[model samples]
Target chain A: MIKENIAFKNLFVTVGTTKFSKLIDTITKKEVLDILQSLGITFVQLQTGKDFPGPKLDPNVEQLCSIRSESGSYTVELEKKITLKYNEYFEDFNNEIEKSDLVISHAGAGTCLEVLHKKKPLLVVINEDLMDNHQMELAEELENQGYLYHCTCNTLVQALKQDFSALKHYSKPEKFVFSRFLDKCIGLSDGK
Target chain B: MLRLLQGLNFKNYTPRYYFIASSDTTSLSKIKELEQSVEKHKQGEYHICKIPRSRVVNQSYITSIFTTLYAILYSIPLVFKIVPDLILCNGPGTCIPVCGLGFLLKTLFIKDVKIVFVESFCRTRTLSLSGKILLYLADVFVVQWMCLKDRIQRADYIGQLM
Candidate 1:
């Protein structure tokens, strides 16, 4: 049971640099909608990369797709439950991530790492339809390590409803390892 | 890598980042993210070069030729102006040309730039096309997975960079 006044409100959805229509489509399902509403999520910022065709909203749901002056900023109101922002490139994307309580994204390494860096509650939905099925390995590894939660088209709603306390136990990636690697590269370059 | 570079103390060496912008829309957002992250740190200088997207698999001959030509042409100015002590690149089709340029500079132009190639984390089983090409040119090649290390003689397994 989701508390009506829980701190988790803002939900940011991103599909990395490729199109994942299936993910967008799955999230708009009626079951997922009910779960989100139960959890009191009001706003959803969807960074649908150039390829995702808009979600298929139910006929009864009132949706207003508006074009604002901003290049990739648009709003879609779904059944008076969630306000969806179909935004392109904006400075606010990271700001939105910082502000978000939970981030739902396709399993792109950059997006996943950014979300983890912010230490937000992340739910990754793997898009198997990708050209190489590239994201599956990383998503599975992270999920197995209890760093982040992952789901497929069939299991997203269940994964969403569960408590994500494991997020707190997940350690932030160490910066020193990469710095050492860079130091080594620099050393090699300078011949020292 | 950008974040790591940004956070460095830089007591001895000044690092410059050079990126080849991808034509894809998602790449645009990534570039924006990188720019913002770097700006937030307020450290280091970087350059972005735009080149034609190179498709390795199932691409027409003409397209491949055009991509190769454009990449080489775009890299010409970069070769001369942005000669760094080391060139660090990850496995991607775009990096092939850049690494090739670095190799050319090292052998012909007598530039002392060392190339470090990090295989993409996505490759758990097989070497990517970019990784395969870079194996011969790169001075130091690192792989995230042990499997890749076993397969490639020169690659060193340095655990994953998460």
Candidate 2:
């Protein structure tokens, strides 16, 4: 089992920059819903980028917050059981990463790195539809490192049933490698 | 690109920003976000160049070469105007023209601009097309995963900077 809170729990699912319609479609399935509930995932937030495919809202959807800018746009919603909150593009998504007990995201590099750095239990649902498919390699590599778990959209329901406690704690290297390298490259001119 | 810029800033190196973006809605929007971030978070000089995409998803290799040359032609004046000391690029079609032009400047001894290429974190086992080209061209080549560094001898594994 992932955890035994016997109380409140939060789940955050993000599809990264692009809209993975299939991801949102698969997660809302009845079977997945049952599995999530059993795992004590009470507060589930789905960040459907740009196109928020309106799922069958049998549970009355409540509007939470909405924001729009020239660069991007996002919306938030609250449901009764799954509490589906949406924020398409956050200025700083670290806040969401910090809050969530579990994060189910597409195997996008940026999202995966951030989630791993935060040391959260992440289940990456790979989008097989992508042209590049490097995401598959990334997700698998992360799994090998014991930093996160990976599965296709179809296998997400099964993947969630596995014990997450056995997963190793991720401590991403915090060394100033880039800066030190840059400093070594160029020395200041006027010596300010 | 934003992460690397922020990292450099945190290291106390005050540097200006010049972005050469591919002419795609998504790419343009991302560039705008970077511009806004520079303005909001730090008082820094920044410029954006909306250059045509050198290559798209399914362009023929012959056409790709032509488009890249075209992109270089469009970007020449801007590259000269900026004449950045260090050119940082990740995985993007825009990088080809930007880095290619920068390399030309270096070749002719017009400027000793150093190029740093970062392979996207997603790429572990192999290099992307951009990564492959930049691998030979970029003065400093960095990879996020150790497996990749092992595959390519030149790539420096810097852990995850994203």
Candidate 3:
């Protein structure tokens, strides 16, 4: 049973660059939109332009006064400013990440790590043109860790509309092992 | 010595770029075709030597020797003469050799020469086995997008190669 007071059922996602990465489906924006719609979520989008900050913010939070001006293409600045703005728009954004049942983020492993740290149930989309499919590799690792759901935009929406707990259960052990592996690989064992 | 290497198709030509590579003499023979095809075309100066077949061990795995040998044999002497500040490496296969030579010349002779790796792959992240080695050797690792910069620890994320 889904709840009613939801302020952000659909997420308008953003990315940092407009380059040739296949991770974000440089060719598949409409596919992403269709999936989001199928998930019973509204499609709020923020494709990056060459502006300093990158794209537009979530429409609801625009009322806040503490919002600072971001730099780089409009879309870039929006992504950079999101965390801080979320802090200011706490209730609205919190409900958004929590009640919406899913948050789809286009950030790479670093940003995905942050989303995982927040314990949000997320769908991570990886672009293809990355070095060794590092983003997908990381997504595989994170999916193993049980941190979030990882897929191309199309797969993600399909997975989200169904029972996510099944996917979540399978991803847990992998995420755990991956976290340990990362700790060892990065030599952060002492948590330093 | 601003030499370019390729089949020299009129489609790939830009103003004043040199043609240095071709798959075979059929392509080599077509250099004249390229010359006459474009309105702004200039005559071919010299033909690039074909890289003989050989085995190469890429960073991730073993590859044909031709990839490493040809790039090195053909590009090194050019680097010594032209001393390009930047080598827009289309991939590890081609750019690695130019960069290796660039590093050697800069360390042993000329100083402050820069090599920029032009990332052309459309999907996947993390440096290719050759790219992994080239990253340490290159002066600037330019990615097509900043998103790539996240996965790559040290690249400059210059937002596109072309």
Candidate 4:
């Protein structure tokens, strides 16, 4: 087994700008962390949306990192090999995404597009609680294309166990195909 | 829409680029980044025009009319300033007034501008609010999803732009 490299985190979980308490509650459990540890994930960065009130962790789980608190937000590391850096939100997650090995995100179209644009390994967790959620279609299409994997809150464990090393990279529609079409529409064609 | 501008081959002609930004607090910082991006990728004159939101959320019909009219008043000068050959917009409230002005310009035999409306990639099954409205106004309407072509008339089933 490879020793944990302390530079970049292995896992990044984000709930976007909305509350996803179930996702937060699910990952914070000891059993899940143990599984992640066995899989050689030494670090976790969780972006719980501002409304989760924070996870009520087990009393026996102790924090393992020294944090410099800014904006009164707590960044804690759990015991065992996995260290967790928790925050309400970053100004942007694009930089964080670049550093992460795997990303678990709520099924927001913005987040899905960003993750896919960066060519990162993505696992989307649909927020069943949202009303008239049209965002699910994007996630479904992405999964169907073999660009990403997906699961609901209940099936996160199974999703985590799935091998993603053989994923078919998402090939974006050629930049100039749409441009050439636009040129025809706008009458900028060479023949015209 | 900025991506479209970036993709254009500028060897022939360098058309003036007008990036319409929503007149909100966040737009100030975004304009800087947008300016830098446009400068890096494309060469030619570029301007960022701020258009106010057409309607405040939860606003009553009476107040909304006034706000929309106010947005139109602000948009008139920007439209004339641009005098664009083509205006490609996604589904945003700000796009409506700009496209309307472009359409008006065509009808009046003023500047000829093609108003192209590209539906947002997120809308697979149905058209967005702007798409619903622009189906009548725009000269060319494009949808990224193929399913949308069957339900909506005059919507070209183009591949995803974003």
DockQ of each: 0.34, 0.47, 0.02, 0.44
Pick by DockQ: which candidate is best? 2
For residues B1-162, what per-residue lDDT tens digits would candidate 2 score against the true structure? Answer: 665655454324434555555446654576567556554555555555678878886577899999889988999998898888888788778888889889999999999999989888778899989998997789999888888999999988866665
Residue B139 Cα positional deviation in candidate 3, in Å, after optimal superposition: 1.2
- In model 1, how large is the Cα lDDT of residue B132? 83
Over 4 Å off in model 1, which ranges?
A: A1-7, A39-43, A49-55, A59-90, A161-163, A168-170, A185-192, B9-19, B22-62, B73-84, B105-112, B124-126, B145-153, B157-162
Per TM-score, the best of the predicted structures is: 4
Which of candidates 2 and 3 reaches a greater TM-score? Answer: 2
Candidates in order: C-alpha RMSD to true structure: 5.4, 5.9, 18.5, 4.5
Ten contiguous residues minimizing lDDT sum, candidate 3 chain B: B1-10
**Model 1 TM-score on chain A:** 0.79
The residue-by-residue lDDT of candidate 3 on A32-54, one tens digit each, is: 43444444554333333233222
Better TM-score candidate (1, 4): 4
Q: Per-residue CA lDDT of candidate 1, range A44-68, in tens? A: 7777777344456544443433323
| Poorly placed runs, candidate 4 (over 4 Å) | A1-9, A17-22, A49-55, A58-73, A190-192, B10-42, B55-66
DockQ score for model 3: 0.02
Score every model by TM-score: 0.72, 0.79, 0.35, 0.80
Q: Give the range of the ten consecutive residues with the poorest summed lDDT in model 2 chain A.
A: A58-67
